[model samples]
Target: MLRILRASGLSSSFTPFRALLSSSSSPDPQRGLSVVFFGTDDFSLPVLNALVEARDCDGSVASIEVVVPKLKDPSAKCTIESVARSAGLRVHVPNRRTTLKYWGLPGAPPPGGSDGDGDDDGEPMEIGPRYDVGVVASFGYLIRPHIASAFRLGIINVHPSDLPRHRGPAPLHHTILAGDTTTAVCLIDVDPTAFDVGALLARSPLDLTTLPDTPFPPPLPVLSSTLAGTGGKLVRSALRSWNATLDAAVDQDRLGAEPSHAPKVSKDDAIVPWATAPAAHVLRLHRAFAGSFDAQAFVTLPARRKPDGARKRVKLLELDVVAAGDPAAGDAAQLAPGTIAFDKPRKRLLVGTADAVGVAVGSLQVEGKAPCSAVDFANAYLRRLLGSGFVV
Candidate 1:
């Protein structure tokens, strides 16, 4: 449901998917299941919207409340708030300074406010429930025991990657990084003080073996595309099924867990080090950085003479993974890891990697200009200065 919104990006930065989510579904909450949702990213949009749609399908929300972190920017804040408000969903942006207690129990309101342990940081805390079940999806804030205990059924988080696996931030990136071909969309119950400890109610496998209809290269575009709504659809379907078997949602094993963590990646993490990366790692790096936080396979070039006798450098973006079988692989394999070798007449740019794997450059952005193809990049900016020998 929300995947449609991700596909319709108006700009590279903020996703307008939330812009259309409100109008796409009905505003009524479902009967029986009342929930308090806590989320702050695009990953959480589908489950939240689905909950709203299911409840509002017939024109009335049985019970639902939202606790969203207060985004400093109004555009960002209003995007989700407007969607919720438009759908008649309750939107709760607890004051960080006033609601600081965990679960926001009737205690001294809260230090600084929002809900978490005693802390003076500006970050918002997950103030516990004023509702029945607490549902969190891609919520950046860490919810403490106070918050989880406040809810009768505990909190249910819509984790993108399979739990007991990629258990922290950047699950999708971590999973992709580990090169796991199979993963799951899990709806786990969050027990107090124990993250990933709640019962495993639903596990829907995610197959990443095949690329999407519209393919975006790694390191940047892929992670930022916000194209996981179909995955969310599967989660919504699984949740509905779980609701039927609510009693069966049992606690998972504490042992035998191969836990992994994907801490929030920063701009500094985006800098690619071609000298050390293996082919597989290089490919994975690009995919992990793709959508958000400036995903790209950046390059720096050696000084080469220009028509005006000045040395020129290049910055390349977007690379396609290729194996030894492709016709371009052999030629690409010979170029240096960061060299730019172009077959402009055929519109091909060969990018070599420290690993044996070769990457074919597809789209690129040079000094101050729109994204251009390998052919254009070569003809206009390269070619004369680079007679080959430069590696990908």
Candidate 2:
């Protein structure tokens, strides 16, 4: 395994792929070619590991460099850079103003002139033969066209969706929100023209709507499987396949390609609206955006009495919607959408909505308590002065 990986021309900034490079005692396969990898998120780890593994497994890879960004979140506390360092790969954090320039000096005869090592008093420094190919995923920077054409091979990217669709910034969240049943791990040509156009080497679809009643998805991972594991595996396949055929290109269907964009979900996106939204719709929104967006919904509490007999608002999170009163058929009052209904003894919250939904609250996290259940939540908090009905 190590021998094959060492020579497979493998490279990427993804970190989890370290699992692939777990073998040793072999000639280093990544010996001669210049390969660069960059990413910041853990999501990129698998591909990064797979690239290293491919070099060992196939014995075709050359030199590899890894790049990771500095994280702003104090809670982030960790990154793929440590993984790259552990693997003994060349790694750098890029800061254009301070780190490496575009490897170019402005107002020169373009780069690639002659060696500064040769005492080039008259000529500019020629960039040493650079990167045969480059791979990028979730690195959070834009690649210019001039840089795109500079690679001896080309830049291959790991985009989280199928080509021509969900192009630009967000793919995963957009796919789930659009309720797309199928998505892919696409290997794309990273060029100035646009992403998803350089020619597709591999495509694998993600099954989101296919969830099952069981806690664990058993066996031959079918429709209804949670996508995390499957998506990672599919991405690995696409990267490996694309590596095997470096020069091939496939013109994709330009017609079905409608650009739907998802900017990174913000704290505002997580403000679960108790008005105008039923629990089911709100639930989906939370799940889709939760990991990246902190799956949460906001609701103003029903009028509560103070010692002075006044009202205050309480926001909620970590909630679930159960079948309201056992899914009856036309046997309920038509509360205004976003109105609150109750099962006080059960500590249940039933929120009505424009969609004609009455969702039973599952779990909840208040401003103070660790995230807990609605029953536990209300028993301790909401049940007091929480009217049996809504002000609306």
Candidate 3:
């Protein structure tokens, strides 16, 4: 039976997969399944590594083949590719526009599928021998029927959010920005036309609020790392005796919820509205944008008249919340919102926000300057002109 582990909390152990593997009886471990994997990002590393480790440990997974995006430069470093190669896994960089081309099937779309407008013509072309199953995580491209059909048992994907929710690319960012307390990793049967509409093989929920023991919410990478570990475990469990459990997969649509999409995070999404947005919201934005592909959350502070008479934007990073009316706030209570004040008693730079809440600045980068501590930034630039005055 398929198992569902909901987010009351998460266990750091890989005991779940190990337990399932030990009890397996359906397909003999001696027969051993071969796997072809599709993935390209850092988030996919853990899952791929887990599979590679499994293959090394037992004969359950006989072979590992990886497919990655075509690199513009042959010398470009792909972390997943590097890890896969180090594990002695076979790697293929297939062009999504012409997958069949990689296999010498000219004029035909790739076996699984391509990013083409229409479906393949006539009958589906057959690719060579098929692997037992396929797995994907953050592969960044859709699979066509031809490629999917090449596998005897089709493909399964490790998605970082609960099915029927956050059913898009940037789940990590959206989950944080929305103030979600919990997130889940789902191992789902891949569907070609619709994204993440596949049947659920396994679900492991993670409690985001309980991590890191911090006063504020955990950072984006913290939750991402946790989910990645959970995802890897789920994949291993789904593949063990997969022939038997595949048929038992549950339909996600029946879960009785409409999924909220997590579109790619945009530059506008990272802007910190210190003067207008709620303190919690500002903090969430900072936490969400931290370590993201895009730059960190920032607000443009008013520029002081320089010797050159040029104004520049001050990009802030490492923002943390401080309760209003802290004794160290001193005269900060009298300053306008968005002001930069030094909390001398606490030895931190405090940025005032809406509702009398203060955001402790750990680090910041002035335009055209290297990143520096908040105190260094104030002493070198802010204190001279603004004298701990309004930021804007």
Q: Which number leads on lDDT?
A: 3
Model 2 stretches with alpha carbons more than 4 Å out: 1-33, 73-78, 96-129, 145-150, 195-197, 211-248, 252-255, 299-321, 324-335, 342-347, 383-392
Q: What is the C-alpha lDDT of each candidate?
A: 0.55, 0.50, 0.66
Tell me the tens digit of each residue's lDDT in model 3 across 210-277.
77675446677877778888888877777775755665667787889787888876766777665686
Error at 316, model 2, angstroms: 6.0
**Winner by TM-score between candidate 2 and candidate 1:** 1
Span of 10 residues, lowest total lDDT, candidate 2: 1-10
TM-score computed on alpha carbons, candidate 1? 0.71
Off by over 4 Å in 3: 1-30, 96-129, 212-216, 293-314, 329-335, 383-392
Q: Give per-residue lDDT, candidate 2, residue 146.
A: 31
TM-score of each: 0.71, 0.68, 0.79
Candidate 1: what lDDT? 0.55
